[model samples]
Target: MELLKKNIHMNRQKSQAVMQVTLEEDFNVPDSKADVGSIIQDEAGVKIEDMKVANGQVMVTGAMEVEVLYVADNKERKVHRLTERLPFEEQINMEGAETGDNVQLKWDIEDLSVSLINSRKLSTRALLTFSAAVEEIYDVSAAVEIHGDGEISSLSKNLDMLQLTVQKKDILRIKDEITLASNKPNIQEVLWKSIQLRGTDIRILDGQLDVKGEFFIFVLYAGDDENGTMQWVETALPFAGTVDCSGCSPSMVDDVELSVASVSLEPRPDYDGEERILALEIVLDLDIKLYEEDKVEILEDVYSPAKELKPVTMQQVYESLVMKNFAKCRSSERVRMENNQPRMLQICHSRGDVKIDDTQVVENGLKVEGAVFADILYITSDDTLPFALMHGVVPFSHVIEVPGIDGTCRYSLKTQLEQLSTTMIDSEELEVKVGINLNALVVRVHKEDCIVDMEEAQLDMKKLAELPGIVGYIVQPGDSLWSIAKQYYTTPDRICRLNNLESEDVQAGNKLIIMKTVEITD
Candidate 1:
């Protein structure tokens, strides 16, 4: 709810008034983390004596039985092809590893492979493990080695679970203190917030405990036991009929207030894989603290798990976004100085460096170096930057697609930039932004959701010459051809194509044309 008050007080020549405002804030923390990696060891011809899953996470639990399906020890620089099948290896070693430990077992496939890759570094033994719950059930079996990693080389795969942890203790204490303070003995497990109680008759009444009033915003506290309803309060839904209550109310008292501060995510490393994090994650570390009178208390303990809200993919954020293709997404903590006046001042734009390497090159044949580009995030507001600030990143890379192939070679790509523009709001002007990204060959088909301006959509022998598609429309009351043209980025003559109108004068019911936007990717 928004509250506004207006008044005028006369001084000698001017009048002024000051108002105070209060707001509520809450903290959010990540509750889970899944990391995948590996652990390697030394051994050979080691068969799977056994395997099992011994952990519980979401849906993991029970005995896990895994078998050694394919294993091989090939040591050759040249590629080998085989169609004929061979018997599997039997009677393998399954000692040393515990019931919960992930183990790798290996065996030689072709005797000739040993000699061919004699000089190569191959893991004589390797282990493969998928995510399994603590109490999961599984079947285990022994089999011969299928593929070889050149020679006796070390290779393994493992998934590690990580629990989120806080980066700042102070922030954690503040958030916890605030949230806990707001939570009060309303009824059972459900707590009522004191700030929501609204009463104009309540200035600081006699005691600072509970405000006296014909309650305005107060919710009636009520609930049904296994039998029937008692005093029902609307704010106690989550704990209604759930928590065992004291069955008695405490003596009426006052002098307490509650509020929320901040929140964060924490992660605890459960496996070696957790050491090296991957692409996606929704975790945080928070610091919270509470204050009363002049005393302060730190509160960082989490009472419950926080569900994932918005899951972001690195691929979409990286490749799909125009920024990461040619240019990498960059971020940094920025500090600035503001004057006493409550207003924003213009500041310099942000600039950073983007390094490109070998992700685009197929092999050692083509190598390109990444270049530095100009970038600036001019946030000219107070405290927080406005979300509407213009932001565009230009990707740069040295084209390596051979010189002779005209357009055939991956030379340079057309620059694409998106922003909430501040200039040219209602003017006919073209602005150009430059950047580079990998562009595929051009393909033109019927535009899917294509934007264009045309005369009409219906097949009319009378005005077939004017209709370019559904890109045109007839002018209506309170409509200008310029706005119609801007909507399609075309001219009145172009609009004349579909509607079949002879002049600029648009009729209220006359049909006008509109163009659809074309789909392009880089």
Candidate 2:
């Protein structure tokens, strides 16, 4: 055991540490010299050397600067609508993400936009800029819902490390469904009242301000067509779009304003066999922004350091892939049981991490006294079978841009996956929720509906045999059915029926037990 030394806190502060980097001067430009077939020299009709030369080096170096951003997340530590917020979140969901899925993150602009090149000097660039008004947002809105049961893991309970991950590829379908759940009901009356008062045309959009514990929302409003008098309602419906101003002219209308409400995401499981996916939905409240005024959307643009701005890294590429997957994701995944046959299973998971004050021998186990952030990323898949379909290489890497530590400003990347938690959280909440029921899938495999059978069935028997409300038996080193019957609660006949015991002698290693949860009353 590596004895505990002075512990170092990983995520102890939120200070934006700045470092001065000297730019290097020299650079080697790629030689563009190409082979050129030579024509006979005008006089000397001899085979001559090919001559095709390219441009020489042109130094375009300068002090390109950047900042770093790093935040942590655990899928299991789900914050509700009113929960406290983090500055930033480095969440990379492989399957996809839903609207209102709070993306908490800390902006590490320094690292992300600087120090990518090997040297400090600047180089030439075929710079390209995009300065065109987006033609249109043909389709501006969509909703996603992931369904799966979240099993408690031991580490999560004791260590409080929670995580969950959903893969983008597992998203079955990305459908476009528009639902007008409820209206203010008094909107029409308010608009008519404004028209009666002789108001002009109406307009709407969201208004954002840096308010603690506050976010933006949208509302409805109306104005008179003749007099240009503007009026709005006190009540608003949460929607997910900006009020169209193209329809209203600026020559007549002054604009409008209304209250805004914040929105968030919530996930829950629906276990109806009729519905293959876990049960939950994403609700987008669009009518939260005050749109009537001339509002400017802030696109944070910071000049990056020469090193931070470079081609995409594997991590970034993976993140983009997951984002694409989640964007096109449907509610759930369908696992193939019998070749073409599919079955549903639970696929919910959550993950979290912490920066302990002191270094320890093993991960997860807390020392006598430790200071930790316990930041978590709570994630849930759309369904049992869909989550099971998620498969890919999950690994970790490091770069100076997203460095593990920065003076007082340190950054750490984390993945909070509850469904595929190969690395136990080492906490109680995690250990209790680490198991899932693949019995349907198992049955399908046995019935020849599934192509492959379960191999290397590795699980803690203590946690495996007795699933929540289910029941089973433990294999003693040298015990038989008759001895077990005399030792405990049930009788020999009951044990025989419970475990499918054939003969008087029972195997010690294999636990023979009946599961109550898997049993059907009907």
- The lDDT per prediction is 0.23, 0.21
Q: What TM-score, to 2 decimals, does candidate 2 have?
A: 0.14
Residues 456-478 of candidate 2: C-alpha lDDT, one tens digit per residue: 22233453234443456777887
Superposed model 1: Cα runs more than 4 Å off: 1-140, 144-345, 348-361, 364-388, 396-522
Candidate 2 stretches greater than 4 Å from native: 1-522
TM-score winner: 2
> How well is each residue in 1-522 modelled by candidate 1, as lDDT tens digits?
111111211101011112111111121111221111111111112122233422311211122111110111222111111111112222222323234432211121111111111222211212322222111112212111112221111112121111111111111121111111123222221111111211111112222212222111111111223422212122211100111112112221111221112112122222443211111111111121111111111111101001111111111000010111222221222222233322324322222223343434333112344443322222234332221122233334454342223321222222212111122211121122333333222111110111111111222233333435345455678776555653443455556665576776775776655653221222
